[model samples]
Target: MIFKMAWKNIWRNKVRTLIILISIVLGIWAGTFILAYAFGLIEQRVNDAIGYEVSHLQIHQPDYLLDNDPQFVIKKSTDLLNTIKKDERVKAASQRTLVHAMLATASNNAGAKTMGIEPQGENTVTQIASCIVDGEYLEDSDKNKILIGKKLAEKLKLKIRSKIVLTFQDTDKNIVSAAFRVKGVFSTYNAGLEQSTIYALKKDLDRLLNLKQEAHEIAILLQGADLVTDFTQEQKSKFAALSIRTWSEIVPELALMTNSLDQYLVIFLLIILLALSFGIINVMLMAVLERVREIGMLMAIGMSKLRLFFMVVLETCLVFCLAAPLGLLLAFGVITYLQNTGLDLSSAYGESYGALGFRTIIYPQLQAVYYLRIMLMVAVTAILASIYPAYTALRLEPVEAIRKI
Candidate 1:
């Protein structure tokens, strides 16, 4: 009975009711889309870090973990590689021989973290082939070919087929130098990584280091994201001597930022709702003030003060109910579309975003669970916004309200 009365009262002033409704709808729609964009940027940064800098899991000797000494090799790495590949949960596995080397071009010299990798295995695990912008990816048949980053190539004044010399400490702590020709140039969103990393064939590095079937790191990619913790724990038991760590352990800052983003989401939503609540409160107060005589007539006819309060509150709730779904649905459709065909900001901002550690192309996505939370928050906001107007209705005397023309 109260709901039916409230519904009829709402339509009595169609223009006013619609004005509030549209405000709520637009507020929620804009808020949700902005949140989705924020999440997309954070997710993209984490994905890029995992895809390019580190795999899902890594194994290294205890000494190597302490200092990354070239002498501390994972013995019988070929056997470990076979064992890792046999795990059903592993999507791809690759061993890499890492060295901190001085790369000298005819024009300049720079420090680089050179990763010597198996061409096929590394391509499967890291998907570096997709980033190749110039020349071609490394080949097993090419003994002395190297892959360089675009930024690094620019700094070193290097190009495809350019010869460069690399000097680094080998297994015996002896300095060794090698000359290799650039096979490709690649680009990544990480400016720091782009300027400091290079790649070559694992067999070539192993020969230069005077070691056979030994590597500094074994990186693994899992079939599913949920499998990372369990797989890492399981591998710890098998290779107790070696230090096995997940991507989180390798890059703690990324995990920290990811965890912090949820708190940020809540904070931003609260601010948006708080701003909307003020407008809602003013509209509801006016609605109550405008119908004082009718409310007094109801009170005189033995309608309880509590029931009058509830009726006014229900009116606000109805407005929210009419608007919330429309807003959520509109935001969801737009966000979903953007997720498939990304929002490219590159043309407007150029690649300068990479210098700030962000990708220009963003694919906005929000988990389904967040939509439910947004609905819950909106309901709470509606209830809170109705408070002041409901109180105003309770304060009016029946005789005084009836006298008001």
Candidate 2:
């Protein structure tokens, strides 16, 4: 009976009810859209980091990461690679010979970290082949073929088939220089990485460094992100001598950003709800004030104070219940459409996003749980917003309220 009365009473003033409903709907819809965008940006950053910067996991000799010395090679790397390949949780694994070398063109020289990778294995573990913007990826048949980033190529004033010399210390502590022709130019979202990394065939680097089949690093991609911890733990037990690190440990800043995203989103939603609550409070109070005489008559006719307060609260809840679902549905449809046709901010803000290693095209995403939480938050805010108006109704003197103009 109270719910039916509250519903009918809220609609008695159609203009006021519509005004409040519109506010609630817009508030929920805007909040949801903003959160979805945030989720998309975070997702993109993590994907790019995993796909290009670091694979899910990496295995390295104890001192190899500390100093890029050619002597600190993983023992029995081929056997370890085979063992890793047989694991069902692993999507791909690649053995790499790493060296810090100076890349020299005829007129310019830049320091870069050279990665010697198996052509096929590297492709499986990283998206280097797909990120090739110009020319072609490395192949087994191509000897001394090198891949450089577009940014680096521009800095060095070099292009495809340009001969560049790499100078580094070999396994025996002797400085050796090898000439490599640029076979591919790749570009990733990360500007810093683009200017300081190079790639070559693992066989060529192993021979140049006199390491035979030994490798300094083994990078692995897991079938899914959820498998990272379990896979890393299992690999740690098997390869205790080698240092195994997940992408989180490799990039702590990215891990921190991902971890704090949920909390930040909660705060963002609360701020929106807080603002909307004030508007609700004003509208509900006006409803109460306008009906003062009617409320007094009901009280005088034996309607209890508690019932009047509860009726007002119920009205507030009904307003939210009516508006929340419509808002959520609209948000869902818009998000779904944007997911397929990404929101392109590139034309307006390409350089800014690129500087932070983010692509300007974003596909907004939110889990089902987020919508549920938003609905709950709206319900709570409605109840809280009704408190002052409900109290004002309870405080009314029936004799005085009935006589007021």
Per-model TM-score, in order, reads: 0.95, 0.95
lDDT of 2 by residue, 89-165 (tens): 88999999999999999999999999998999999988989989989999988899999999999999989999999
Model 2 lDDT on a 0 to 1 scale: 0.91
lDDT score of residue 278 within candidate 1: 90
Q: Model 2 RMSD to the real structure?
A: 1.7
Supply candidate 2's per-residue lDDT for 57.
89
**TM-score for candidate 2:** 0.95
Tens-digit per-residue lDDT, 1-405, candidate 1 = 999998988888899888888888888998898889989988998777778878898999989988878989999998999999998999999999999999999889999999999999998889678899999999899988899999999999999999999999998999999999999999887777788899999998898888788999999998987899999999999899999999888989888888898888888888888888898899889989999999889899999999999999999888888888999999999999999998899887646778766889899999999899999999999999988999999998999999998
Q: Could you tell me which 10 consecutive residues in candidate 2 have the lowest summed lDDT?
A: 187-196
Q: Each candidate: what lDDT?
A: 0.90, 0.91
Pairs in steric clash, model 1 = none
